[model samples]
Target: MSKGVIVGIDIGSTKICAVAGIMDEVGKVKILDIVEEPTQRGRVSNGTVVNLEFTAKDIDRILNVLSDKAEINIHNVIVNISGENVEGKAHQSFLTRDDSRSTIRKEEIERLAVDIRKSFRPTAGNIIIHTFPQEFIVDRAHVPDNPIGRFGITLGGNFFLISTPNDPHLALRRTIESVGVKVQNNHRFVPLKIVHTLFTPLADAMAVLSEIDKKLGVAVVNIGGDTTEIAIFQESGLRHISVIPFAGKSITNDLVKAFQILPDHAEKLKLIMGAIPPDEVGKNDIIKIPGVEGLPDKEIVAQNVSIIIEERVKEIASMVMAEIMHSGYDGQLISGVVLTGGTSNIAMIKEVFTKVTNGMNIRVGNTIRNIGQTAVAKIADPKYATVVGLVLSGFMPLDERVPEEVIWGDIPESQVSIGSYNNGFDTPNSKLNGKKEEPPQEEEQSGGGIFGWFKKKVSSAGKIDMGDDKNYTN
Candidate 1:
């Protein structure tokens, strides 16, 4: 068995959280430490870094806390990115073999994926983040999940391509690099890598979605502090993904504006009072809202709080339902909608979602199913789903032909130049130069393909192991 420590950073509009954990030879993850701090206002918005310098400082603080607690010098990390500018589109490509009798090879499948990626022309300020295959068609007669080694004269593939604005993408990388964390690599472009940037919803799906759920059709709704991300899966592939510029923070803002209360007080009321049903609250029940400075404590009816929360929660749910319908898989979600993220913790969220979707199966999603270890118990909340998934994605095996689906844009050679290095952080001469290297060539596997690399790493001797029972401070 082999083991190694990996760090995952989740940068959100409301908070910055860093998680370090150990992955065993068999892919079980044990949390070593988790550290988080409130993101300064204006530093991040809708999961995008708005203020580069302040965001960098926040990341540095979070990394320092994690490093101090884990008692390790962190060098590299997998980070997540999301925002309103992030979007997903459906695309397909076809390839024909010269000989009709020849069996389809993995390389040919990969070439088809490359063709699909090249066909996409992202807007000037945007770049493709991921391109995941939905299914493969061989010889116009058979449709298989994996077409490698199949006999065919022609092969075709349907893919889901995800893209994000370049400004936010570059800002996120710059912030991480400013903290001395390395964010450059092109190691085979495998889906399962310890250090790379990935879409937040995709990472969340990796951690929480099962193969059964994907095959049966399901939508993962991640409600973050500033955004609600939706990813729909069907036939064991990603079908649609989107970001709604509203979430828990939006609810808090509503409360603040409605009650004229401080943001902190509004948040406390939202969490403590809970989004209870209005009818459940007693007519006489009243909650006290602590006053600030010279202001006197204000008393409001519990029913009123419930009403305020219910309205916003319902609105968010309706928006999610709309996105699902737009995905064209409205009635195909056999597994229903799975709600996750910090906001999913809101009282009655599932109930609200069920009502909005007209009684579709609804449930709250957490990391308990995939994560093991008592240390992670405290962080097993829905809020940590994205970061937890980021860590878990490092251990999940990559599909054979999917490696070619990793579409990193043409990075300028100028960005490849490494500038001065100090304090474990290397400052790039320019932020725009963070280009990914070309994937290395490897012999295609007859059956296992690139997945064999994972098995070899897991079973290999002399694996790097984090020592036992080291000092870790809370």
Candidate 2:
């Protein structure tokens, strides 16, 4: 495949975001442009395309804006899809070797994956979007991280399958195509293919998680406008994924009803004053809101705002904790939970999570630290996590990737082979000969003083450095 720019488009419930970037020789992502526009009501819901015409127009507008800003004609994009309709299931497939003593080969593994894919049968109105291998079991006795050269008569392992309802899937595809851009085609075993639909939480995990985090077990919670997505990883693989139907929108609705305020005003108030308990908000502080129509203005105590937000946040946190427990990896996640997405920016969110999880460690996940560029402040918001992760997904090496073979429209399984996996493992030139290649090492810069630590923190926070210039805040 030719190397060039990669674009990641996040069609979210609240907004649509597009990120354009290029992966450098050293595998660093350099931002070219970022654009976002609100998703008008009824256009999209819970990450699924509901109105093709409206969505297509919005997608076209963002793509055109992004193209103009980046000075390139964007044709394809890696999109993220999420919602309650999107589901995940766990399954294990076994393959017996012809020779009991023969060692497992790369082709054998590839064939096993293909067989597993072919065996899956989605519901009548659904199609599989992604299939991920969690681990490899050899002879039902030994579990090897990589079973390429392991000798075993029987080979089997756990796999996680993600599927979405067909109606939304087809609607999303038609919306993209309606804009006159060809969706990137998926090829068997191709590396870093650009055109695919990714699970939103999975994409968010890829963008914020480190190698250690994945190996030690971690849960990523992406709280979006209308839904909250959860992805669990352990041993460098996906273990569990789920979408909570309630999220930031739920909190906004709660605020709207609690304060008897307009929906728009409630959203604005939530963003401005939302916080968990012990957030240092003064009880006597009052916030005035313009009344609807000709009604008199209302004065609400800041403490009341915190109280309303705290209750909703606690409920959400409890739900997340319940999901973690249900995943059966509750105590196994040494890396704890990484909260991300737009709602993660809420004040004292980490505290709420910690309280709900019985003092489990929690950290806010952001992509700013992973990006290698100076002017990335615009995309530093956690709201851009999925899109940033989608861009980063295009830069991952083949072996470390998963198949993003989206079943387009209602196309027959024969048209797009059921076993057509594009994770780069089936390529003829693949070097999966029982040897792992070391990733390219980056040169380190030395800095350890107090000032250096402060500088590093500032950089991680996506702040621009201007020597001798006064800092400003928005």
Candidate 3:
């Protein structure tokens, strides 16, 4: 009967959105309210911060609205980071005991993770954010997902590590902190997979699928303004995740180029005249829009506009299909593709998706869960899935295993010394020791175990609430 509220924020190049909700005893979230606002032009690019100040202000406004609507105190949030630079690479790590009599234990698993993290850095200044345990093996024998109790001399784990540019992580933390909210300890490392799989998943799972098709492999494509994120679901965990650079903004750019119009005007026209089927557009359907200076107000054919935009949309669809093929998911997705995001609202988007996916059954996903069937049908837009997914993930028991540590260093170009902080803070410091010295502890992380001291705190609380202080719950 007890409930606690948490917030989820997603900062993208085109828009910033926040959702607040309460988690029930079983760790299910009931969304309270969601707030969204557009990013000022040029403030953010491809999930990276181009203007910290403006981005902070925009996020501040959205948070304020969400807080008021939800009627809850907001301090920490689970944020989403997706872009070209945010990449997921698979790697395998093995831990060998010095003594043959030694057996593999959870501590050994933690050590192996620490070792894997060491080799994660790229020459281009990237910082590790999320880690996925693909599989674990003991004594050269494949083991099930759980290996804590098994006895073995060697512990091996296959991991998919996701990282982003150090600079973006730093800048985003600075912006979020400037808005007077503390980010979670594992803010950067929290995986979106956890959110999608745990909360509102049935809907996302059903986006392009029917109940009968659940057993068949299916992929969900979220084509947003800044990033196109893909998720493939098998029987259990997600098989693959990728962030592509192509999305709605590319179509907007195409409109600007082909129409010889200002970027803003082009975006507006595309929204009004945007449609997937060129045949549906009438030749006489002309929209009057302001033309460039020295030219009269122009009358443009809506069909011509549709053709140009559809061409780009088709290309994006093709790229996603290509990715699915390359992922070796061919004939794997029985349910076909589920398309969601703000860009999914484009006129005739479902038709386009259906055509591109060919034999696969496709449907627009709606983020309606726990709500009644009627409301689910009314709010059936795909654009809000991420925000809803954020709320869904927000409600799950927080992975208190890792306290917020400063993964990215000080923000460059600013003269601010920024105070003593750790991995919880995303932005880099402008000055250190008044000499710009690197923090010594960056190389030596505290909380030696993967589920460190912070996890112990949460686990202890759970035990007390269960009226059994002698037993710890994870």
Candidate 4:
């Protein structure tokens, strides 16, 4: 329970994980402990909170368990968030340097970089998360890196920008605030400060990808329960990113619809019994599944189930293939695809990807480099890559938008009212209250959710009652 210890909370579609650890002297993230709890399905879908109250409860439950295991009142933490709303696009930013300046001064280069960030105006209700300059052009020539001290009249940067809507971003912080770390001294609560907010795909890249693969051009496709994030990297930097709706959930739902089984059973059938290519399954095999209530046991052909799984897996891969092609790094990715997340553990998934991407040397990334706690080598497994990456922030902090320091957001670790207007969010803080807009739900996928987190009190007994969502309604 040292002051330097920072916790990482990863809220995903199917589960919530809280990890407490500190970087060891050897520059490795030492795992102190980890605690996980079910996300109760769609409470948090595609990494965005839908029912703020229920999501808060789930997060609070996990953190409380972590606080007890670590034997301390954990406070500040780094967070990873995602959603289908997360999108990235290639953009051009240019500046015409004046002749009077003579030389390209440091500030001039810096000004040009900031100006490009300003130029990217997302649609209303959206904000830029991070802007990465892929190449610096000086006088129509590409400047591999620093453009300073170089002589040029036209200074420009070709960038790939990442952005998401403000509503979900706000909802994430408010959800954290509502579940703020509980105090033990008295029956009171304080805002659980967020030290940093990161993109899930970026964090997964940090844990699952190596520098060599990056330089050789690699794609990270994290297939989680409700979403699959695609990140294409080359020259040791991000070139494009996207979040798609087809993922493990889509496959599970397909099984549910085709097999007439519950979600849990369908998921097990997918994981334990499913495989690529119907030929991998026996033609005459019969699998029996227990029926709900008092009905007779259901019988299904094994090859037919495998065929269904393979078809859905193909669907997910097709979408992923389209994204890689869209990135324009399609042919250049020598390292090919590095798949992460729970669904990546599927049998023969590599062959599926290899077939889809025309044999791109696909590999499943399951281990983290220089990771401590070797006894449980893959300490966190692929599912917790985001949180594990956060734990390694001491040494592997995310790269700044540019060489110069420009802090877009700095939310200090201080107590505040989650409900009242005095909350400490750097942005104008408020509960999206009466205007709980529900984003379009694709099939069963709703990218948007409710937000009514308040400065609810938690008793000294370590219990909180946030009450009903009706109280905050319009």
Candidate 5:
């Protein structure tokens, strides 16, 4: 209520990242901390908490570590949920009256969205995570980005429904609740949507498709650890989205298969070899790889490594390009392709992308603004986009823009009052909600690292004490 510090959690397969920041009176968000913890299995299949208990424990550990470092609470943080199954489809719905000439009001349009979502409810125990209103059409005329007040006989809207399996949803909810923290939101949105929101200046599906040179329609390719998300934009709105089930991990896996090495060694070799041309690598160039259990150490040809990686990268890029071409954009993404995510960090990836895509416009994406110069020099390292976007997304207050009165989905008919949970708010704690407390002495001492000076200033308030008194479990 007092413009509290905001936190963003991006739970990915490879790692769970937590970024916390506070906005000053002037409205600039200063990132306080960024922390990552490797998942026990290194990735969550299809974004579900397959191993719910293990995943929850890992999340708790990361939250504890970050809370200490940032000296902030993660209990009420804004988290982003993304995965292959999470999808967005544009649906057009309208309020039609048997008799024409009935003037439409803002409430009518609000109800229109609610009605649309209600129509698509799953018969099973699944949940719609997010309902995004894309644009409004009033009669024959187009309305503003979010049309609510315009008067018209018929109101139409383009909405996106994001859903997930009910079990995973329950697990995510129960896990966070178990840690004494409420799930602020489960934005069943995708990584690309977050990227578009955080970095509006870049080539968003709508921006590239509608605003950019027609010849250069853009393919926003986001390469993550286990999956690569490809979205095609032509003439401004999203045309298509496809998820390839291979990415950095695939390349890492390829190295293992070809060299008969362990994943760790293969991953290191993949990152070090970078993306190079198969032909450029000489056959005699050998690299030593550690021996596997019961096997002698091996010597592999660098050419073989290059050939293997190039083949995989080319195949993946081709799949993405095929998605773009299938979208039937007016021309090739003359603007070329804008890449982002961890896989984009592979050295010479841009070159490989160009070769694979027949030389379209290609470059890596970043949050050029928001991040400080010093942090930019360090954090601008592309792989941090989603985590950075998670932090930045908190700064944009979506609820403030929408009316507070309209309900977006069907209300459950539970015997107990669920009003407190209706509007994305938490219920006040009572004895029934027994809470736990963490020790104050475990809070990270601030003055020893990059943020040492900040720790000194905040702690110097002489009001600083061990944060063990907080209502959270260890």
Candidate 6:
């Protein structure tokens, strides 16, 4: 492990949460400590930084507590960027080669990525957050995967580029740097700031998704105070992302408008009453609200509250479903939807999503392989997933590759099962009825292909051990 400790700060409209975590010797993520602070009214709208000064102060307070608990100097944090200003669009780039016989190198592909950024600015003042590769085209033909070592005349790449307005991008950096968190790259001569800014939907995917889930396809629906973030992943890549303005705050506002109550009171009712489908609650059950200035208390039916909550929840769910379908990956999501954020915890909120999305496999988000099952409170809450992702950022890049079928495929039955005992044979499937073994053919009788005369040879003899470097073979 190059680095032991990582800190992630999740800056949301409702609150700011910081998490300090370390990858232990056994390779499990261990949460060191955590600290949280409210964003204060009007400082942040949704996930955007409206007031840089106060946002910096809120982050500073949280950093102070986390730094003390972790006993480490707090600088260089993994943070996220979000809000309506952020958007993603398709981008393509071509690296033309004069001679088709020239072999492509890794450096050339990296150069292509660097050169591609210059073309992403559709409008002025837009900064690219990420350039996710959708596919690589070699000589106008599809290659199996990343074609760094191939020979081709034209290398074209299809990408999904995420970008934000310069104002928000600069504001986010300024807020973090104001609180003493500066991102620096000393190993490389060129200064790089791209490594520090992770888009929110990608962070949500990192915290809750697994390799199979992403490879098979999955969607992350993050329901927050002021916005709902939806991201679709297919073939181990982020295919789409959408931010909806309707969220928990909308439900609170509806309650305030219908009952003529205070915003705080409405928020309280939404949280305590629980947002469930209207039919789940009985109509006769009523919760009395104490009126202000010694006025008469008002009686409110539980079913009415359910009705208001369910309506807004359904609208958000409908938009979420629409974004997934619009991505054109609706049928490919075998892992289905994984829900996160504070609003996702509402009672039976998933019930509404299931019904709206036509019964996809929707479940509340949890760390798939990012963290082990633990007693830490933050580990269990979906609200802290973004911060946890920030902490996990040090271990792996956003682009996680699925294993190729050719290199690692299914194995045959072992010795106990009377088929393939080891990798001594070259058959994809070696099956024999009962315990009898099949005799070798005429070609196998000759000492050819390194396996002399049907004799078995051990191609690999090693066990997987993370701590021992010699255990691995090339």
For candidate 5, the per-residue lDDT at 151 reads: 52
Q: How well does model 2 score by local distance difference test?
A: 0.71
Structure candidate 2, residue pairs in collision: 189-422
Q: Give candidate 4 regions above 4 Å deviation.
A: 1-3, 96-110, 146-154, 183-189, 275-280, 373-380, 393-395, 400-474
> So what's the TM-score on candidate 4?
0.79
lDDT of 3 by residue, 1-474 (tens): 113665667666777777676764554455667777877788867656688788777776777676666666676565666665555565565667665465555555555555555544432466656554545667777653557767777777555555567776766665566566322432322211112111122224422334334336677788878667776654333456666667888888888888778888888877776644566788889878786777888777788789878887887787677667756676788777778877777877777767887867776675664332221233346766765555544433112221112111222222123233222222244322333324422322335222342343234231111111111111
For candidate 1, give the lDDT of residue 309: 87
Q: What lDDT tens digits, residue by residue, belong to model 6 across residues 1-474?
A: 126667788888777898877777887777787888866898879678788887777877777777666676655577878896677766666767766787876545554454454444433445555667666667767653668678888776666767677667766775576565322322222111222667776788888988788888899888888888888878766677777776788889999999988888888899877645456688798878889888888889888888888888888888788677667787789999999888887886888889998989999987645875343665668887777887777566566322111111122122224333222221223332254433422322434321331132122112111122111212
lDDT of 5 by residue, 1-474 (tens): 214655556666666776666666677666777778766673476444567677767766776677667666554554555555554455566666433555555446555655555455332434555554544666756553455444566666655554444455545655555654322243221111111112111212211223453223567777777777776544333445555566778888878877778888997898767655455667699988878677888888887787777777777787676656655652556677877766787666777788877778788865555543222344565666666655655554322223422222332333125233333211121121343322224446654421453344345342311122122211
lDDT of 2 at 457: 32
Q: Could you tell me the lDDT of residue 328 within candidate 2?
A: 78
Q: Which ten-residue region of model 2 has the weakest summed lDDT?
A: 465-474
Q: List the residue pairs that clash in candidate 1.
A: 415-433
| Worst 10-residue lDDT window, candidate 3 | 464-473
TM-score of 5: 0.71
lDDT computed for candidate 4? 0.69
Candidate 1 clashes: the total is 1
After the best TM-score superposition of candidate 4, give how far the Cα of residue 346 lies from its true spot, in angstroms: 0.2
* TM-score (C-alpha, index-matched) for candidate 1: 0.81
Error of 5 at 246 (Å): 1.6
Which stretches of candidate 6 lie above 4 Å from their native place? 98-103, 181-195, 275-280, 373-375, 400-474
